[model samples]
Target: MIMQSLRGRLFLGLTAVIVLAGGLGGLLTYQWAFDEAIEMQDSVLIQIGSVLQHGAQSAPAETPLAGVDSDAEVVIRELGTAPRGAVADRQLWGFADGLRTDSLQGRPVRLLLRSRPDGSRFAVAQQTAIRNEIAGELAFRALVPIAALIPCLMLVTALVINRSFQPVKRLAAKLNARQADDLDKLPVENAPRELHPFIASINGLLERIRLMVDQQRRFIADAAHELRTPITALSLQAENLEQLLLSDDGRARLASLRTGMSRTKHLLEQLLALARYEMGRPGKSPLVSLDQVAKDVVAELLPEAVERGVDLGFEIIEPSWVRAELVALAAMIRNLLDNALRFTPRGGHIDLGIYRQGEAAVLQIEDSGPGIAPADMARIFEPFYRGGRPSGDGSGLGLSIVKRIVENLGGTIAIENIQGAGLSGLRVTVELHHECDARATGRQQAPAAVPAES
Candidate 1:
């Protein structure tokens, strides 16, 4: 995942470089500063030694360098070339005139030994640990600023990286939010120069996708039209054959052929409808009577339901309106009713309703049939996705067409089990933005056709 995101990788890489460089640079700088401080301290020791030789101060006292800078831990000792005082003092007097490393009181010290004008020997000494301590302090103080700047640099790096990748993030969001059917070209304006070519390539791909989708819809439309003529002619010929059928077996065969022909015709009509909606429809939406649309579709399919011994009627027919194209609304309701009537068993009941729900108009259809399986509910709207067990004859495109129509009309549909509706069945509820087109034209008429059960 880190590798997949350019921003994350760049931020990490840059941070690693900053930390590595800062650490190395800080160490090198400390080392160099320590060395320089040591040299300067050595120079101080030499100057003090030169002054002492010129009778600058008497240093035969018991304490270490009393009159010098308090922080400078140096001890001036007097020793005679006779090598006569203590064995340690005699050992110190043995060194020649210059600076040397020696031990004083069993501890390491930097000693500057010189012969005085009267030939007496004197030593300027500083403990090695004290010299190193001073150098280390100065070096660490010098490194503090650089250390502080490292965190600041990291913060700046993060900010710059985030800002630089904003365009990519924005582009990703735009792509992710786009509908699958939306093949609009990506916008390149205001994008970074580095992403211009990438944006252009994406736009080209979108154009190709748009063209492919258009061609597919057009082909479906053309194929349905081309098949319609022959199928109608065949239906006429089949009717003519039915007039002269001789035997029962032949009649049965003819009936089966007619059934197949009817199913084929229905399938072709569904395909054409699907193609028509997919190509886009309804430039401007007007007020549509939701209750009226549902009633008309239910009425059209009433004869079929009656033949199947299914009771189909409106349960709640309120005066509800929606802002949508009338044709699209009719098709959507027709498909839902058709599905319900097909699935319902003999003597089963189906319910149609329309009422105001919050800010939308709700059109609900409930059927007394086995509801969809738990697993297949999510994918029922997908085209041709017959569930694990398809119960009825269908082109598998009915619901697909209905879903497209609903989306084009800016409505939402949901299907679930009718839990406590006195039937183990499926319930479909469609919600669309409500708009009362004619509030003045009151609908006091109870329902145009509410059956005895309602």
Candidate 2:
């Protein structure tokens, strides 16, 4: 079960073909060179034999080149017509004048026999093994170029294949870097011709998805707006009914009805916020003091914290400024505090912090409540995802709204369960890039915390 990458498969197939062709061509080349070398050696033997027959009368009875070296092993000797010599020499005298293979001493040799006008027979011979060794060396030399060429061909092929696939890699990088709401058409002007069809298909799919998302946002926003009027009217009517006298049981039921209506109204409000932040774009952000925003949000929510007997205050505050919308930033902070208040039990505490670290402005919120379940952590930011332990009259859209606002401002939010040191709760931390110095704005510094009355 090997994963077949296109590039890998192409390289392997081409390399195999190159090796096969080189091997076959090399085999043919070696055989041809070997045969030619053997023939050239045979021609040398005939020349020597001719020289011996013409110069025999002037020279000694035997040639001085006999067993001179391993390479020049030619032997020359004259024999009378009566065949008076060793068994091997006598055997050669019986043969006709031409080239022939015979055994001399105990090893095989190639012989060229001839006769003069005097009727004396002579022979010139060399060992067969020495001739073959010379031929093999010549043939091997002919194969060096082909042996070197195969690897060079394979290397060039690899480089070409890699260069050709660069466009695909660039396309993937562009897609990966895009924001979630980026639905603009991709540019095809500079892309390769082979990728034009693929780019067009992707652009078409993006257009369709953008349209569907627009429709969904419109439906949610429109429905919430339409329902607000009736919900307000009903709440006023229920308040007016308090003027009439009622039994204890009836009063209890009326209280429940009011709670239900309140919850419904909160849910509708959250839905409208989510739709607005999701579909609308942030344009021309201005610098705002992050600590000031946190203080304002905490001041507004202090009365509710006091009513519930919860200690809610800023643990640390520093002057930090960020570029973002004032309204959106306040909403983000308010939603986080509201979520913390809903889960924190009476006598429990909530701590808020705002500070600067390097080029980033950090906002952190920690609450003393039951920590999130391991299973629910993955979907905590999803819309209407109430955790395993649903608490209070929560609409389950607080975190979703906060997340949308955070992302709209080009910031990041991380949520994790607080553990160790005998503490257990949820901590949310957000980091935003700093814009400018807070002291340069000439605004008055606000207090870190506004405690509710006892």
Candidate 3:
């Protein structure tokens, strides 16, 4: 049988303890019984000796045969065969001598011996059969109590061990009754101290899993809700184009339909990017230059900046590199710059800079625009969360994507208002672990400038 369960193991352990204790007790009882029986036998022998000596001295010399009794047989034999100076016999001699004594078998016998001077006779008397019976009774009595107690003691020990494990049994029952969705903390009171930590840790892991599952569920629902609108819009536009295909008004309607389709596509691309960031499935990371990423984002967004008549610029405070996924870093920088350019008014300035501060590489972006309110600042990075109504067309996903990418790259992002930047734009600072300086020799060449447009 499998003995891996708690009940099995506990039963085996309790059984072992019971058997050991009972065996030890039985062994001690047996030893005591033997010792007691031996003691009783010695007393019987001494009494027989005393009686034989008394009878021998009391009997007349002329009445030697008259004093012969079966009860004293043991003593008479011992006296007759005893060595000249011997005080005791070397072996147990039964009541077969000329002396008799009380026997353990409940009979009596007489004992007789000859005095050394002039061949005078003496008599000893004892009940030999009664003495033997008493010895047998004593041995039986000693064993009876132990035999009676063994089963009772074993039963009581089993009960005690089983009672001691009740708490563990209760815990198992409670755990088994819980539902799969129950991520609540366990009740630890009255639990064994050794097991409490394990229960608590399991509960902690369950709680984290519950939170992640909830987050994923919410993200799916939101994504579906957000995607439905654009899909409906595209469908309506297609239907309209199909209905009005033969006139000048149809051409205008088609242009409008194309614009709606383009916007929908952009939204879908942003949604896909968010999903990818969440899933962490953009393949393996590689080494990339944060400064180069910043330049590339600026270059890609330069046309948008020019269309808005905003001045976008970047500065490299340190020549360094970091190990990361190049595409993820580019996406993160692109989103941040996009947000800045979107918020900045025409003629407003957007500055992006990379520098090393101690062991961290810091990327700071400052733009001239309306800064976020204090209450909205804390949750700006949450997915699909927009800070009030945004100043320009936006999907409210830019900061969320940037946050996820930075986290995946093992970096941190912080934002605050830049008060004296003329326009009320925000300052976002991202900090990454600093890579080894590539220009420690003080003669390193500068990287070629990347154009504001690819």
Candidate 2 contains a number of clashing pairs equal to: 0
Candidate 1 residue 66 C-alpha distance from true site, Å: 3.2
TM-score, per-candidate, Cα-based: 0.75, 0.75, 0.48
Model 3, C-alpha of 174: deviation from truth (Å): 24
Question: What is the TM-score (0 to 1) of candidate 3?
Answer: 0.48
lDDT at residue 188 of model 1 (Cα atoms): 84
TM-score pick, better of 1 and 3: 1
lDDT of model 3, residue 197: 83
lDDT (10s digit) by residue, model 1, range 1-454: 9978888898889989999999999999999999999998899889888988997766773347766667777888888656777877888877888988878788999989888878787888888999999999999999998899999999999999999888988999999999898887888888999999999999999999889999999998999989989999999999999889469999999999999999899888888888988887746666667787777777878899999999999899987877666667777877888778878889899988888978889989999988888999888888888787685568888789888888877788888987774659989988888775455665332245432100
- How much lDDT does each candidate structure score? 0.83, 0.84, 0.66
When summed lDDT is taken over every stretch of 10 residues in candidate 2, the lowest stretch is 445-454
Task: Show pairs that collide, candidate 1.
Answer: none
Tens-digit per-residue lDDT, 55-157, candidate 2: 6352344664643454766667677666986887788888889998877778888888888777888887778888788889989999999999999999999
Which ranking of candidates, highest lDDT first?
2, 1, 3
